[model samples]
Target: MAEPILKWAGGKRQLLDELYARFPASYGRYHEPFVGGGALFFDLEPADAAINDANPRLIGFYERVRDEPEALIERLEAFDDPDADPDPSLPYHEETARGRDVESYYYQQRARFNRRPYEGAFDPLEEAALLLYLNRTCYNGLYRENADGGFNVPAGRYANPDWVQRDRIRRASDVLAEAAIRNDDFAYVLDAADPGDLVYFDPPYEPMSATASFNEYSADGFDREDQRRLLDVASELDEAGVRVVLSNSGVMYEPYADAGFRVETEDATRAINSDPDSRDAVDEIVATNVPPEDRGSAGQRELSGF
Candidate 1:
């Protein structure tokens, strides 16, 4: 199976089994409005699907991946050159080994990526390569932008951070071949999804606590109002006979349940916390349009058991 191309903050790789178990045996086209990292998308590899996100850079990257994987890989190969001179005194990856300025190259690349011309169409190849490099080398693989919509995550301290995977990119291109990728609001999925189609909503979750809140996936962070709007859209999809599934912080279960959806709690490890001690298991909910037949087994499984 093709793996996720990026290291997204709230990626669902850990919960794949639970998600698969809850999914219908088979369905029509797949729809993921909030396609961060796309762990499940790559896993399912649906022939016909509609994937979307509000992040234009991310959408552009995927579009390029679908249309020009070979070109992206060719550009990404530059990072793997062990002897490539990023500076006179050091190779890009050999800086720490040579006892020279180790982080300067990373910072320079970060600055270059941030300084990319945001006017007209974003540079697909350059932005995509920069995004791949930063996520691999940045602290905790977090993608955060400043108020001016610039990529601003600081460089991480990996002795030798892994660069792009050639094979994975080709595999992802095959999966996205028959899909319609879009950069649009999550609610706009209603236009593409027909009855019997599956739509998964992995929105920026509600904050469980003040210190634990890390919703800055974009400059326009997901707020309570966005959550409310998503709930409304999910409800409308359910009424239209579309199969809807969503993942969010456990605190936002009332509205989903009140909307007549079945909600199940699962333990998820919050791995992106700055404080290492706080990277503990937290509660997350999986809400589905159809009540799970195994509702009686909900309490049988521990929150972290998945």
Candidate 2:
């Protein structure tokens, strides 16, 4: 299966089995609004998909992959070349990794990325290349933005890092051709989804405890209010006869239960945690409106073992 190129915090790579188990056996278009690290989207590789995120650079990168795979690959190749001539405009980091200094290289790219005018014309290839580089080299592959709307994750020291996966990139690009990617609020799915369509909401999880809050991913952080709003949207979709599945903190599933949604719990280890000792498995919830019996033929057989 094609995989996400960027290392996204709260990415759902490990929970794929649980998600697949609960997914409707058959459905129409697939919609994922908080498509971070798109573990589900790429794994499913649905023929018709509407994937979106609030991050513009991310959307632009996906667009480049879908419309300009060759160009994106070429730019990534250039970034991967350690001996390639350096441009004066882009600075390299002082710290050396794998016999190469990349601290300045990372910062320079980060600065340039933040400098790009949001509404102005810019090269999509550059945006894609920088995002890939930062994601690969940044701390735990986390994509945390500052309140000023700048990429601020520190560089991760890796003697030998896997910076480029050309085949994977090409594969993702090919799969993305069947998707409609957008940079919009999660609610945008409301207008895009129809009855029988499946919508998967993977919003930033509501903190399960006082010390576990990692909700400040985007500049406009997702809070409890946003969680309630999302529930409202999911209810609307559920009432409209649309298939809706979602993942969030296990504790947060209480709200889903209260709303009359089916909730299942799974244990997931956080991939981006800085403290190794604190990386133990935590409870995550997979709530859906599609019951096992109504999961169509495929879901029926797949869920039979349960």
Candidate 3:
């Protein structure tokens, strides 16, 4: 299966099996309203899919990957090209003892990305490439934006990171060829979805505690109001005969349960945790309108005899 192009903070890479089991056996169209990283979407690779995200630049990156894979790969190659004379503008964090000014190079690229020209010189293609590079090399591979919608992530210290994922990008492009990319609110799925289709809602998770909030993948943090609004949307989709499946933090237990859906908690991997020892697994709530009988046990099949 093709991998996700970006390393999104709350990405659903670890929940793939749980998600697939609960998915409708058959559906007309696939919709991911909050398509961050889209690990499951890449795994499923539905032919007629519509994926949207609040991050306009992320959406643009997907569009670029789908339409201009060659161009994207070319730029990535330029970023990874060690043989070529290093451009004074772009930064390459060298791992060897002959170390370059790592922080200086990374922040410089970050500034260039934030101050990208809209029309004349620096094109959208370059901007998209920079986004990929930044996400790959940034601290913990986390894509966190500042209040001004600027990309404000520090550089990661890696010996030799796969900064240029040429094959991965090519594979992702092939998969996204079938998907319609969008840059809009998650509510856009309501109008785009039809009966017999499927919509998976993986919104910014409800924080477990006031101090534990990590929903700032974008500038505008997802609040409790947004969470409630999403639940309403899910209910509307359920009523319209569209299959609805959602994943959120454990704090959403009451709300999702009250909405008359099958709610189950599964241990999922959290890739970006400050406490290194605490990065194993956390209980995440998975609520879906897919009938209990229809949904299979992802874990049961793994047993030698079941």
State the lDDT of candidate 3 residue by residue for 94-125, as single tens digits: 32122324345565556557653212234679
Q: Per-candidate TM vs. native?
A: 0.86, 0.88, 0.88
Candidate 2 C-alpha error for residue 20, in Å: 1.0
lDDT of 1 at 118: 33
lDDT of each: 0.77, 0.78, 0.78
Regarding lDDT, does 1 or 2 come out ahead? 2
* After superposition, candidate 2 runs with Cα above 4 Å error: 80-103, 117-122, 296-306
Comparison by TM-score, 2 against 3, better one: 2
Reference-based lDDT, residue 126, model 2: 87
Clashing pairs in 3: none
| Prediction 1 global C-alpha lDDT | 0.77
**Candidate 2 lDDT, tens digit per residue, 1-306?**
577777778877778777777778788899999998777787777899999998888898888888888887777776643323345645334422223344456655555565544224456788787888778877677888878666778777776666665776888998999789989889888889999999999999988898878976778888888999999999999999899989999888789999989998899998778876888899999999999887644321111100
